[model samples]
Target: MKNDFTLEVYSENAFSVLNRMINIFNRRRIRIRSLLATELEADYKHGMASFKLHTTAEQLERAMHQLEKLIEVERVVRIN
Candidate 1:
């Protein structure tokens, strides 16, 4: 049951954090459909990244849990 899911990640401007986040899906061979980034704060190290991809619910759950564990990640939420 693969369906589209959007993951919104609130994180700092480490940049590396973004790579790690993408690696979560890349390691599993899941291709991200799209990605958008926006600045949330005037300071340098704060922003949000939105990722859209298609995957099974079970896999998404695991990926979300993993995303939350990253030190730079402030929050991770599903948009749909």
Candidate 2:
């Protein structure tokens, strides 16, 4: 049921945003298979966090929705 998601965080405070996202997963008890953050090569000023979690589809959707509401987050989308 779990899926991969690519999150592009646009704020200057990218580290803070990543921390908050980790907290979100922790609080929800979602076990993450892989969580990686990398600076976007095209947009040198921005960063992207890629997450692969072990969770249900509904739970993933809810988490993505919540992520989109964060101030430091730019966009949340499930990757194919």
Candidate 3:
């Protein structure tokens, strides 16, 4: 069975932050189906990034854990 997972990451608006997030997927050899980034707050430029990937439950959990560990990531949420 395949599961589609969405990772919502809140972090600073910077290219390094985005690059780090993409590296997580690359290192896992997971292909991201979609990636969206937007500013959450205008003043601070807090960014929200959503990544969609289809994979097994175990891999999804691992990916979430890795993403949460990033210093720039303020929060991580898993979406069905």
Best by TM-score: 1
| Candidate 3, 1-72: lDDT as tens digits | 567788899987776898999999889888799999888886856899999987788887898899889888
Locate the minimum summed-lDDT window of 10 residues in model 2: 4-13
lDDT of 2 at 25: 78
With a 3 Å backbone cut-off (N, CA, C), the pairs that clash in candidate 3 are none
Give per-residue lDDT, candidate 1, residue 25: 92
Reference-based TM-score of each model: 0.93, 0.77, 0.89
| TM-score, prediction 1 | 0.93
Estimate, for each residue in 28-74, the C-alpha lDDT of model 1 and write its tens digit.
77669999988788787698999998899889999999999999999
Each prediction's total of clashing residue pairs, residues at least 3 apart in sequence or on different chains, is 0, 0, 0
Runs in model 1 deviating more than 4 A are: none
- By TM-score rank, best first, the candidates go 1, 3, 2
Residues 1-80, model 2: lDDT tens digits = 66544444344345577888888778888887787787776656677787777777787778777788888788776774
RMSD of each: 1.0, 2.9, 1.3
Minimum summed lDDT over a 10-residue window in model 3 is located at 37-46
